[model samples]
Target: MSHDIDFAQSAIRTIKSERDAIDKLIPRIDGTFTQACQIMLNCKGRVVVVGMGKSGHIGNKIAATLASTGTPAFFVHPGEASHGDMGMITADDVVLALSNSGNTAELVMLIPLLKRLGTPLISMTGNENSALAQAADVNLDTYVEKEACPLDLAPTSSTTVSLVLGDALAIALLEAKGFTPEDFAFSHPGGSLGRKLLLKVTDIMHTGQQLPIVSLSTPLKEALIVISQKGLGMTAIADSQSQLLGVFTDGDLRRVLDQELNLHTTPISQVMTTQCKTVNADMLAAEALNIMEDHKITNLVVVNQQNKIEGVIHLHDIIKAGVV
Candidate 1:
């Protein structure tokens, strides 16, 4: 066979082997999965992950996923644990140990110490009957049909199944804990997701002197000037008490032109939309975008409890805030 042809065949075989391994894992997600999730959910301290070699790499990623999703967790290398890292694991913590053979020397050595600390032990193992599996309070079987490696020496498909299993457990615990996007944002305040969920209308809305407001008695021509000055494509009309009366938008101008109404002589209140949608200043910018999209409008008046216009927020502002 040509070199390229042989390489392609090898790649395809590897992919198919991994696919079958994951398929087999689907049936293994049962009561044992729920049992593990319960232990993590009830854990008040943290999920202490321990693993050796290739499993340690996957364990670190699982720890990160769990920490960001609501269940606080951190990884402890099994080799290091034997020296002094074992002190990081506490009685209030739940230990999640990973071992393909379920008898990794570095990790199995910690079983007695974990038991002494009175910590709940959950193990992920390929061999269900190995020492680690038998010693764990709850054992998650990460068995696979075969490794993707033709020699069956490298951890290929086994690592993939183990990583996916860790994600499933983390998400299950996240759902059970009533984790919300707002809660997740708190965990990742520096990320784009945090900005989208945590930023409120007031944070981006134009307030006070920047607001483009016209009185209900204002002429349509003058209101157009206000809209042009604010450049928000719209202007709000209020009563003497500053209570919002209606809104005159560029769309309304189109409808007015259809009737051949003279802007210079017309009153803005005559053509303004009285039922304009408004959002609270404290509402999330993402939620404001949703309201604008639902109403098919680009601008929203930010209001207070008294129905007075506190500020204005436009689709552009939400987009600029990276909330779109």
Candidate 2:
């Protein structure tokens, strides 16, 4: 209810604090960080992340990032691990533990169990010498000078540093594994990325009766009719053997009208675009989109190795397929 309260100033201070905390982590990406990555890279099983409270929230995100970026990982709550979820972890797995204080009771309790299983332990902690960090095979120091919280009680700056460090580890592993965008798309099959990477021109092209095709000897008026009937705004000019010669589009029709040419008598080949763009059946739809964008064309002719017309791809098709 204090109208004059400086909420903006408080927010700016908090942002600066977290930014500083992240900056401090740059020098700490040392040999220990490399050792942790090597351990996880050699892991035959998943990287099991464990944390409690605020750290637990950051751990969940870290696990998801790892899984999406070519690293096999999942999160297990520390409290649940003590009860029975410890069964989920194996000797072949590596454990990633997070604790700002490095002395979280729930996480510390699982240290003995993890050690007994002979699992490699990697810890992210604000205190390098705390119980959890001391027990870790490779410890990452996530220490910050102070919390963004004015009272220095809330988990603010510490959580941001941990999240950034986790992201760094995930990216490093991703690069080491040579993970490609196609591989990332496979993990996210239901998203737009999958459609862009996996969907091909053949999957959405109009073939068979839907193809707008006109012969080289066909009259311009008749070709226009075929284009109108096919609703593709263009008609491919091909020979008897279905080998593409050229294309006539709505733009060509406009140019013909300007010249007062006899549409009924003029042949389609006389006005067709000889250097029309064409894409292969196996080409990615996203690549097709780039071609369309670069050439400022709406429709593309799909052809085979012999330059035979196979189908027609429209901008609307790629948009409908969600590759755009």
Candidate 3:
């Protein structure tokens, strides 16, 4: 037995419907959208998002996106708000309500209370004439021509438009506030992104006695021992004032091996790479990784502005810290 259904065509229709719905939203991102953004931007407490059913689900995600991107926000289920969660909202906050019908009972029921508390209301609804939209300080019209659902009863294209609009609002606010990737990383500190943005060379570099160091007069053979003992595959050659002069790495060792020079008798300065790639201790570890990749080297010597050796940051240390 075979089915007549064209699964790919059905999916394509749904995707196109949602895409077109999002395109319609572009024109709606005008004065009202700007007013909504201004309200959230001026909010001192947080952006409290509330909705019912599918709208509620999208509201949760929108709140999270706002929170992670510099605008502090959180979701409050409208049903729960009627009971006691309403207290979570304050006059300092700005309420962002999501309802395709514009009159979700749960959300609408809280309008009077929201108004009484002097909390600014921003609504995303398909109907501009909705009670929620009328009551809101600003309304974002997320109207959709039709649902992607064949029955046209399910929240399909409308929900997609709401999600896209929510993302647009968050990103616009983020840009207006001058939000940076570093600021975003602070909100997601446990992830790899956090490590990449927050971990500085000083945080991962081998400092103090842990740094493999050798003097200009140290024998090439002795510097090799320091490299091995420190297990960094490299050693920094500094002057008597601890000023960085050069660096000797495992790669350099390979090149030196091809030479007939006596490792035991030759001074490290003669064999070390004088023009070494170095990073400041305060430089982001991710940036250090970029420098290392650009130079095709595995380690970097951390130096101060005065050319004084501070620490050694290895590619391994960056990888271990999840900044790679």
Q: For every model shown, what is its TM-score relative to the native structure? A: 0.83, 0.88, 0.89
RMSD (CA, Å), each prediction:
3.3, 2.6, 2.5
Error (Å) of candidate 3 at residue 229 is 1.9
**lDDT computed for candidate 3:** 0.93
Model 1, poorest ten-residue lDDT window?
1-10
lDDT of 3 by residue, 40-76 (tens): 9999999999999999999999999999999999999
Which sequence of candidate numbers ranks them by TM-score, best first?
3, 2, 1
Over 4 Å off, model 2: 1-4, 188-195, 322-324
lDDT string for model 2 (1-324, tens) is 657768999999999999999988999899999999999999999999999999999999999999999999999999999889999999999999999999999989998998899999999999988999999999999999899999999999999999999999999999999999999998898899999999999999999999998888899989989988999999999989999999998998899999999988999888999999999999999999999999999999999999999999999999999998
1-324 per-residue lDDT for model 1 (tens digits): 654458888999999999899999998889999989988888989999988899999999999999999999999999899999998999999999999999999988999999999999999999999999999999999988679998999999999999999999989988998999989999987778998989999999999888899997788999999999989999999988889988999999989999998889899989999998999988999999999999899999988889998999999998888877
Candidate 3: worst-modelled 10 consecutive residues by lDDT? 24-33
Candidate 1, residue 45: how far the Cα is off, in Å: 1.7
Model 1 misplaced regions, further than 4 Å: 1-5, 26-31, 82-84, 128-131, 178-199, 254-267
